[model samples]
Target chain A: MKAKAFAARLALALVAAGNAASVACAADFDWKKFQGKTVTFLANNNPVAQALLAHKADFEKLTGITLKVDGYQEQQMRQRLVTVMNARSDEVDVFMSLPSREGPQFAAAGWYADLTPMTKGAVAGDYDYAGLSQALLKAGTFDGKLTSMPMNIEGPILYYRTDILKKCGVEPPATIKDIEPAAKKLKACDANITPFVSRGLKPAIAYTFSNMLHNIGGNYIANGKSNLCSAKGKEALATYSGLLRDYGPPGVVNYSFQQISALYRSGRAAMSFESSNELRTVMDGGERLKDTALVPFPAGDAGQVPTAIGWGMAVSAHSKQPEAAWYFVQWATSPEIQKRMALQGIAPPRSAVANDPAYRKWIEEEPVRKQWQAALDVLAAKGSSEVGYPIVANPESREFIGQAVQDLILKQKTVDQACADADKGLDALIAQK
Target chain B: MSEAAATFTEDRQRLELAALSAPAVIFTVAMIAFPVVYTVWLGLHSFSSTGKQSFVGLANYSRLLADTEFWHGLWVTIALYVLSLVLQLVFGVWLALVLFHAKRLPGIVRSLFISPFMMPPVVAGMMWLVILDPSLGAANYILQSLGLPPSEWLASPVWVIPTVALIDTWQWTPYVALIVLGGLQSLPPSVYEAAQIDGASAFKTFQRITLPLLLPTIVTATILRSVDLLRFFDIIYITTQGGPGNASNTLNIYGFRVGFEFFNIGYASALMLTLTAIVFGAVLAFNRLRGAVAW
Candidate 1:
């Protein structure tokens, strides 16, 4: 009996030691565990991807993985992704996606591999998963599945010419209501310059206009129907259109980010509201570098409810190497790489990266960039991703919203009439769901 | 040869013809006939982006008939078509006459005249988008310098259709001129000699002889231009994306959005089918006109 008890104790001690060793192994997570694995990344050739790709050599060196990147323009990238995903081809292992735009749609289509397990099991030692924004992560999650990881946080922010505003003898706008007055003053001061600009194209208007719509306390949908006919909705529609109609550039209605950036960069516009992703474009020639200031769009009834969205890194559900893909995603969105991306003007999704000293020093180098970082901070704290109607038809819903605003800008209809028309169309789309 | 030998030779010839044409026949069945038949099949069903499909019969068609956007797209398509077609035809003939009279024009000058048409439509759209920008464009700058009011070329909803039509006319007028020039060259000089003997004025001769003789060529041009103009997509898509209140939303643009953006495949197929019917009917009518005017 004594011999048997001693043998049992020895077995228990061996098992405990094995458990301890495994725990230590997990603590020192292996970055090179997936060495020699290949990951194909479908990347949109946007600034964020450009920034990440610049440091791709570092990732390859650190992880020993062959990263094959297929980059295309944004719309073309989405089209390619859709075709590849629909065919259930394992051609793409990792891809960039805008979760706010296509998260639910892709999730419903079963195109996104659920990353919940990989995120918990395969993260690095200093991954600090909790450092990522909860709100953004929630945006990327659908039906309890973590579909993607946020790459860069962005939204429309007001980029104003300090010299123009000062020359026009106008104070900086403090509320959404003040923007029209400031625009008028700027136009009166100089008829040659375009006073203001924002997105007016049908598909792109939602990203900018949603800031106004949300700030004015309007909801895209309420009571299971489109609520564009609500009082605040009409108010937002009229105000946004009225600004462009009265003091905007002559073809303001055709302006999207590309035009808006061009106009602002040329020092011909007093104010421009465009995506934060456009910082590099707007600052390209360094002409407006000294005189420009960035701000979260001004307050309104809802008190500065900015629209914030981020492109995410998602492993394809059809990926033959999903776990390997997750390694790429985790490493790309890791604190160290994101810190590097943040210095290069990609707003990091992790709070820790934002607080990194190198990133802080980089922002401090330029006054405009400092203000940009400050505005992004505000966005991170209080932004919402409800750019359009939250439905499977969200992208289609934006068209109706843009149409209503465009109608008002053209004076084709009264605010009430425009809102009613939009609601009619949106209601049909809503019913489709 | 005997009768049996002759019959065998005929059979061999028939077999040779089939073997020679087999690739083209297979190509047509695979490429053209398959997609068209699939599109028709898609139109009769409700299809979702997630591979969910069900038979919905005429429901999509009925929805389209009631949809205001469809009617608006149709109206916009017709307006653009008529405006562009009229402008191209008038300018095409006038330029053709000018080129016909300039018998000693240099090859380089003729190439320059046709350069705009040679540019791809998307490139033309982008080039014009910059040149016609309301604020920073050279067009408005020139207008300002000349003490003329600058016009919102592509931005004004009231004028977007005309502006897009003008852009199309600018690009395709050269192509039309080339076609009309071909017709002018093919005309027999005997008619002109006879008119000269009759002491007919240039204007009078052109009205009575040239125009009447040119009607068939013009109708041919119209049929070709009309089919394209009715399904106009690229320039409008690149420049405005049928925006400024759906002012330039042609049937093709609307159909593309429905199919690709909304991924409402069933409804989009129905919309495209209707557009196809309209284009087909228009071509049929133009062909009838051409037959009536043929010499």
Candidate 2:
């Protein structure tokens, strides 16, 4: 009889403990009020979709709100959002934006609702929202107003083959100067292998080159003036051109990110500068590239800096249910949920989740994650904004810069001449406004 | 009384005729005329796709005059149109001639030859891109197997334009061939028979008889192909996207980039109007040429 009584008391105590934990996990706000409301969420291609899908049932059960998630390619999403925003339509309730380009433009246009009012008081204090990295949060801010929330923190990194480097008796390059010698040594070691490879074709080639340009203290445009004719800019262009002409694959002039990744993964190229997002693709189920390693983006004469580009979620100005949207945003970006996302190999934007013990265990086991963290560290120090020029508001800027790069690299035009020609054209375009 | 009744019936008949044609005329005006008028109006102003508009009056046109990219695109369009048209016509007429003389298994063979025209332009471009891909494309693989130097068909700036032209030719030549074949089959068989009876050799008969009789059909095919090829977009967009430094960008691609991609609607409108005028002029010139030939 005494033992039975003790057992019952222990059972009740355990049940109470479980109830208390569940209560703590539940959001402080009244989720029932949002019942019957439908929310549309838009995102660029990110793995967060899977996590949202996984927890969607729980959210619906708690709030009785239906969530519809839509994903688009980065550029397409940007164009769509711009069209809708410019038209002042409520077609999208929430949208994914990149800090460097879309955030500033959208914020300037007042397309994003100011979230400072929504994120204050009891709700803000209930959540551990303070753990977001200060630098990343600052990037998302525009003129002292918080417009968007960061989803994943990402920057460029050097992807290399460990086996190949070992065979060549060389280490991965730590700086821009080291790259050439390492490439030469690797080339000498293996004639069949491309020493270094990068995307040097039209349009997207400029994106890869921009990272290097930023590291070398080169600016595309500065102080409301075109600065492509600067000495640093010229040297950056020459270095990029020389790398492609001398060390890159034979037909790399027409390559893009996909082609560069393919070359590196296929063991045809020794190393490349690529994004962390491509890590999953490179390391998945391929014997040839399973041993790939990631490192910080090489340092330039100015310093080691990688240009950070990432997509973040922002509530549209047209949303009818700002409160409900906030609830979903809070849920999605919460430390608990972000930790879950990290376990599933998705890069969470929250600093707390990124440094969590559970998340670190998984990251340590994966070579790609180690590289990603290394790249992130370098980015934290020397990373610059992806925004080059406000004149790039027009999409033709991408094409114009891309053509200039092609002219300098493939057509052998002097950097000054090429940039001057491009500047002249872009000036005309901007002047038309 | 009889004269009044006759006049009333005649007036009623004229009214009926007018009423019968009203819907067709109204439909054309609404669908076609309104947009053309709107494009012209929009062309006169500096309109943005973002709903920002200002009256720029002839400034867009002036810009077009100084625009090097526009001029480059215009020349590329001309080169593509002329090259593709000439090659397609030559190959098309040759194929028509061969098919006209064919007998057994000719129908099957002709269907197979013209099958490329049945595929959509996007699909056709994708097929060609794969076949011509520098790295793993079947074309390069076969070249390697045959111990020949591999050519960077799409990568080389010098060859990129010609390569795109070749793709256009490959896909469209069959369309011209089919049209020309229809025309050839419709020709009176007795003309050739008469030439044969007159002791004319095959080549002489072809040059003297078939050539003269096929002039109208050839002219029609030329006009049709030229107009369509001038507006070429899909193949170029899919294959090279006008790249390796804008080597294949025609006026259509340029307008699309400006109007849609860059949101410069006013400039794009002006560019479109210029393209339309060029097309219209070419058609008029070709019609005049055909009239002289017929006379």
Pairs that collide in candidate 1 are: none
Task: Quote the positional error of residue B294 for candidate 2 in Å.
Answer: 5.8
Ten residues in sequence with the least summed lDDT for candidate 2 chain A: A118-127
Q: Label model 1 with its docking quality class.
A: medium
The DockQ figures for the candidates are: 0.65, 0.36
Q: Write the per-residue lDDT of candidate 2 for residues B1-295, one digit (tens) a residue.
A: 6999999999999999999999998998899989899888878888553456789999999999999889999999999898888899999999888877775656677789888888999899878876876765688889889999988888778888888889988888888887788888888889878887899998998898777877877888888888888888899877777777888889998997777666667898899999999988888888887887672
If scored against the real structure, what TM-score would every candidate get? 0.92, 0.85
How far off is residue A117 in model 1, in Å? 1.4
Best by TM-score: 1
* Docking level of model 2: acceptable
Compute the lDDT of residue A175 as modeled in candidate 2: 83
Clashing pairs counted in every model: 0, 0
Summing lDDT over every window of 10 consecutive residues in candidate 1 chain B, give the lowest-scoring window. Answer: B45-54
Model 1 Cα lDDT, one tens digit per residue, B220-284: 99998999999999999989888777888888999888877777788999999999999999999
